[model samples]
Target: MTDISTETRSVVIEREFPFPSEKIWRALTQPHLIQEWLMKSDFKPAVDHRFSFNADWGSVDCKVLEVEPNKTLSYSWDAYGLESIVTWTLTPTGTGTHLRM
Candidate 1:
């Protein structure tokens, strides 16, 4: 019998930004801003929405999983035989916003 299986793991990166959640949220949801920092994408902060992120090298197939204005965005990333979920969360902080990825 041929066995097909895949292993999954979670990766979390956290940082504190001196910027308000609203500002950071704009950069995360706005295609133009995302293109400046990440890649050219048709991303929308809409759940169940499908999008593509493109680059000079290649592109990745993605689907939005969850979105909470100024709070969270989660999606599926599939490319090069690897599949992963990336979730970004922002929380109000005394200093500014706490960003997690």
Candidate 2:
């Protein structure tokens, strides 16, 4: 069981990575790398691509909304009786790239 709130709002998360955007992009779009951090499934970077993230408990059905190489990536996350859009923005900073989720 999980808490489900009626009110909806977008949650933003930001992190500063001490590496270039290409490296981070690979980790984000690559299925193997993503599975290492997120879940096990076939994930691609093509626009409108539908994929799933599978775990022991359940899975999430997602569709790619937007994809800009190493710049921005947006997708739909639906599961557990909830649906939300998750967008990741990578901005090049002075020393590294700033990743926002």
Question: lDDT of candidate 1?
Answer: 0.93
TM-scores, all candidates, are 0.91, 0.91
lDDT of 2 at 98: 98
Cα lDDT of model 2 by residue, 5-93, tens digit? 68978778899999999999999999999999999978899899999999999999999999999999999999986899999999999
- Alpha-carbon runs more than 4 Å astray in model 1: 1-5
Candidate 1, residues 2-83: lDDT per residue as tens digits?
8887665677899999999999999999999999999999998899999999999999999999998999999999999798
RMSD of each: 1.7, 3.2
**What is the lDDT, from 0 to 100, of the residue 32 in candidate 2?**
94
Runs of candidate 2 exceeding 4 Å displacement: 1-6
The total of clashing pairs for model 1 equals 0
